[model samples]
Target: MTTRSRTAGPILLAATILVGLMAGTFFIFACAVMPALSRSEDRVFVQVMRDINDVIQNPLFLLAFMGALLLSAAAAWQSRAEPHRWWTWSGCAAYALVFLVTVVVNVPLNDQLASATGSATAARADFEDAWVAWNAVRAGLSVAGLGLLAAALTVRGRR
Candidate 1:
């Protein structure tokens, strides 16, 4: 393989793994932890969700997002002159779509929830509705990203 292809392949793989981890975290956070917290009458769940939101808004998440974006972009650029070009482009497209949905739908909902009153009972209905809607979209996008990642891997292996 050419030097450029060698470097780009590992970077693309790392990006795929990063995206998968982020997407997996979303599933675990929204589906398992949040649901458990919401069911409890204790305020612990509210606090947990708030903490989670804060963490999600932290610079680390943004940095990871940016890294994923860059890696995908790099992969696309290299793929233009390499084999398995479609896999790289498709993976980038899927990751971009996931990021777009997160920025557009999920982030706003999270911001609203963060500013909301902390009373679990009062906020339960609204939180649940928003969480369900946002998570549904997130889960769908994550699955698509996973599929694209798998395709990319297959293509890379064949090269």
Candidate 2:
């Protein structure tokens, strides 16, 4: 392999893994956490979700969250000369959408949910459905990105 392709291989691998981690996180929330929360009492749902949002800001999550974007971008750039570069480029594009949705839609909704007052039921009503819907969307997008990255890694050197 060429020097750039060799370099791209490891960076792309790390990017794929981080993206997969994030994809699994969103998928778990969509398929399990939100579904379980949907059946809970409003107080329980609101409190648990608030706690989750608070706790999810720690280092490890941030690493995966930010690393997925940064590394995927790096991987795409590094692989730009490879014949199979389109997969990495497309994967980065997909993750870019995931990042955009998280920032634009999900984070703002989380902020809105955080500031909600008066009743737990009201907070849950405002937060749960929208959060669940967007989580599902991000999950699908992240998974697709992961698939594209993995394809880039495994199908290297091909046209």
Candidate 2, residues 1-159, lDDT tens digits: the string is 677756777888999999999999999999998998888899998888988999999999999999999999999999777765899999999999999999999999888878898799888888888889999999999999999999998878454
Off by over 4 Å in 1: 1-3, 42-44
Tell me how far the alpha carbon of residue 46 in candidate 2 is from the true structure, in angstroms, after superposition. 0.4
Looking at model 2, the pairs that clash are none
Go through the candidates in order and give each one's C-alpha lDDT. Answer: 0.72, 0.91
The sequence of per-residue lDDT tens digits that candidate 1 reaches over residues 32-68 is 8766776777466556767887877678777777777
Off by over 4 Å in 2: 1-3, 157-159
lDDT of 1 at 14: 76
Q: Alpha-carbon error at 18 in model 1, in Å? A: 0.7
